[model samples]
Target chain A: MFNAIVSADTLRATLDSVSVLVDECKIHLTDEGIEIRAVDPANVGMVDLRLDATAFESYETDGGIIGVNLSRLEEFAGMADAGQLIQLELDEETRKLHVQIDGLEGTLALIDPDSIRQEPDLPDLDLPARVVLEGKDIDRAVTAADMVSDHIALGVETDEEAFYVDAEGDTDDVHFELGRDDLIDLVAGDAHSLFSLDYLKDMNKAIPKDAEIEMELGEEFPVKMHFDIAEGDGTVTYMLAPRIQSD
Target chain B: MFNAIVSADTLRATLDSVSVLVDECKIHLTDEGIEIRAVDPANVGMVDLRLDATAFESYETDGGIIGVNLSRLEEFAGMADAGQLIQLELDEETRKLHVQIDGLEGTLALIDPDSIRQEPDLPDLDLPARVVLEGKDIDRAVTAADMVSDHIALGVETDEEAFYVDAEGDTDDVHFELGRDDLIDLVAGDAHSLFSLDYLKDMNKAIPKDAEIEMELGEEFPVKMHFDIAEGDGTVTYMLAPRIQSD
Candidate 1:
């Protein structure tokens, strides 16, 4: 048994953060909090989300798993404004999730938990470089790179003492760089990786401009971004496998 | 010779007003101002637009006709933000309209005046009812009607002493009414007519919320909406043929 009250905004941010990488996920609701870990079907990206009890207006659970179609949730949640209060309750007998707003309630059929893919095991990596900055900065760089190329390279150019996002098109190239003082903080190391701009562009939608983002990277290795949502009540982590650059 | 500098907002609003109904138009640049009148290919709607010389930052034009594709102009004008200075220059020798903004100058080819459709003759209408209100009020009513039906009936409810926009769907009916106190003014008469929501919805995009809209209607007659644009330097008139109500 699990039921809770939360803002439409918090729910939207939570689902949107994971729906970008996976279509469905099994939400684990426990007495302490809630957690969801899922990976993209192509094995290219993974999203891990966790929210403590404090995140919900009122929360109670007897420890259970609820499988849901995130794509559908995105649409249902879209109907409510950001500030509206949303109530969620499980209809165990009918295998449905009841979503209630001010004067309306929509019953959504829950997917069988067995149908969803199993969660991926978290990888252990000694990423050499770490950078902290506003999510909007990376969002801006991603938008600029998309105008020029399909892929962008994130790297710390040691010699230049600056981090850069670079993209090259057939006839044009774009590059945005930030020095030490420009970033919130930097644990500089010899690290660089290229990634698909398409993925980054979709990921940016879930990240608000004012939110802080911490990034970890290594030479020819995957990139990881960590951020908080629900007013710091929940944490969302994104890990994307790097695309190899062919010379 | 026709050359003028106008605010991007005025140009966008002017082109958007007529382009909603007609694709190609012949702009007449007379010493008084610029004007265009066109009807949609289906002959269901007519848009008449006029802007005085005062609307332009700088104006100079010896009476001349310039054929243009309003759809293409919409795209070019969209490149500049509202309030930006947009310079329009015509090169008679090249048959080109040069639009200059900031560091960019886009040259759009002009359609041959002979190839465009002939100007439409203004129809004489004796609509019996007149309603004056904010353009936004009609915009809101149209949007609500779109949710329930494709055609909406507009008329005065003499018994109720109110102007009503009514639409009936398969299982739902929506009606927005404005009493005399709620409207700017209303000249009530024995009038009722149905109009396609599709045409009204498209026309609403060009009508600013702050502009005053005057509407005329009669039993089984065409509906005419009039409003000013370009800071009162221009007036855009829209006449939509009525859709027969199939009771």
Candidate 2:
């Protein structure tokens, strides 16, 4: 008996998003190393996906398995009826996953799981400041930046009791603010950073509304976001290097 | 001051959808002839948009005004804050519409208004049997057809007491049935028609869940779907020629 649990929509949306950045997906199945990676076709972008194994209600495997063409699985999963159970069965020889719901059936052909590029070696960043904010607030901030700029600087200062997202280009600068009350909680004196708007937008697509996202920030350090999709269901995390701002 | 009222998401979703079919758009303003012509780049697909003066909430024009490049307007409209007011101010020389929301301002460059394509001359046919059904039900039927086939055959007969949508391909055939109880009303002696699933899917995108849609059918006549959108804020009706099924 095998039991694995995750939101169908969340997984579908995440893959749809990450597929936009890379062509091949490499996923590690370590109880602790649940991460997926792919290098952008243009070689300009890379996706580093990390999720906590504790989030899975049940995980039991006598042997490891790998597969290819995750985008096909994502497409089939996207069509899943909301709230419907997504049952996955792995065919050992074909290396295909038969995904069945109550009324729909689809067999997603697997790709060479080994072909996925290795995850980049990111240093364990000690982000000093962390903040818990509403998912919708960050969504709106990203959308505002999408209007006028390609990059954004996110700044959170606990002492100032404010969170600011600023995007400035040759033409105009767009800014979104959330004050003290807007923050569910804030632990300051450590993290503040800037990142590419493109990466943040892609990562934010999978974040469901009402999900409390915990963000870790550090000057010139990579930004990390932890997503709690549902209680005891699964936790998805993301880390992206900050884009250096040239004055 | 010029004011036009439309359903926010409805108009946005519709334009976003139809834009996939055509490129340049030309709208004509005349006392006797009021229509919008959007032609596909290949000249194969055309959307002939027509609305009578009576459909307008308020019509004020000293001389007819024409506009082109609907795609630009659609893009700006998409970015307008949801549920916010959209105002258009025409700059005659540059042929640009200064689009303004309550607090936002932007410009949509217009194409050559004189290059509007001529509307297709479709003759009015006598369709004997018509049925009124729920929008959501038909949408579901079309979606199911989309799963199995590229075309669908619609059969409506009062004697049969039910409407049927059937699609068949190499793998499987799918049929969706809506009974008399499911229909708002039915007026039929004998009627049957078939149309390309592709066009039907495009048409269904304009329909809202709760709207009442009237379908007119006949053996060889083009199928017609009449419904109001934006809570009757505007009217969008379509007539599609039937596809002759091959033996």
DockQ scores for all predicted structures: 0.04, 0.04
Error of 2 at B106 (Å): 2.0
Off by over 4 Å in 1: A1-247
Q: What would the TM-scores of all predictions be?
A: 0.54, 0.51
Residue by residue across B23-131, what tens digits does model 2's lDDT show? 5555555553245545444333345455544544334444455554546557556656677655555666665656554334555556665665545554576888788
Provide all candidates' interface root-mean-square deviations: 9.0, 6.0
Which residue pairs of candidate 1 clash? none
lDDT of 1 by residue, B28-89 (tens): 99988998989888788898889999999999988899999988888888889876999999
Instruction: List runs of model 2 lying over 4 Å from the truth.
Output: A1-247, B1-7, B13-21, B29-72, B114-117
Rounded to one decimal, what is candidate 1's iRMSD? 9.0
* Candidate 1's TM-score: 0.54
Give the DockQ (C-alpha) for candidate 2. 0.04
- Model 1: per-residue lDDT, tens digit, A39-157? 88878788889988898888988988999988766655665677888788888898777676543345667889899998987697889898888998998899999999999999887
| lDDT at A11, model 2 | 59
Q: Could you say which candidate leads in DockQ? A: 2
